[model samples]
Target: MPVPAKRRSSSKGRRGRANKGLAKKTLAKCSKCGKPTMPHHVCPFCGNYQGKEIIKSKVKKKAGSKK
Candidate 1:
């Protein structure tokens, strides 16, 4: 193995480590529900993706009906 006998190698290693903020992830909003969600993924709040509903969020409310 060849050893580095220069100061250039130390600075090069830190360059990549200091630029992590440039690669921050961004989340997109759903057009239907107006909620933040990952890009290219189905919106969990309204269960929609790509102008289509992928999942349904329906809850049946029980009525206190006296028989």
Candidate 2:
């Protein structure tokens, strides 16, 4: 059986693992609401995609504020 000839250094091991960390999410500005959102996806704030309304975002009312 083959085995490691020398013990791997902690710094080298950490360096290798550095690339394994989570990457930052790529986001684009919403055309309608001007909010940050994922590219090619519907804007959660305005529900617009590619300058069109894809989702009809509804405004939620406070439970205590009733007519």
Candidate 3:
């Protein structure tokens, strides 16, 4: 394996690391519920996709006192 001829400078290393940072995620609004979601994906809040219900939402039911 060919090794580097000279030690990399700190400025050069820093410059390369700068572009490694993550970019902000792009979000789209759900037409039915008006919630922010990833484009072409089902809405997590309401289980909807493209203005239609694809997966049934698992809503927690209120627990009642058992006698």
- Candidate whose lDDT is highest: 2
Residue pairs in collision within model 3: none
Cα lDDT listed for each candidate: 0.75, 0.83, 0.80
The per-residue C-alpha lDDT of model 1 at residue 39 equals 95
Ranking by lDDT: 2, 3, 1
What 10-residue stretch in candidate 2 is worst by lDDT? 57-66
How much lDDT does candidate 1 score? 0.75
Model 2 per-residue lDDT tens digits across residues 2-67 = 999999999999999999977999999988888899998988877889988888765323333567
Write one digit per residue (lDDT tens) for candidate 3, span 1-67: 9988998999999999998887899999989888798999998777889778897765312122333
Better of 1 and 2 by TM-score: 2
Listed in order, each prediction's TM-score against the native is 0.49, 0.60, 0.60
Could you give the candidate ranking by TM-score, starting with the highest? 2, 3, 1
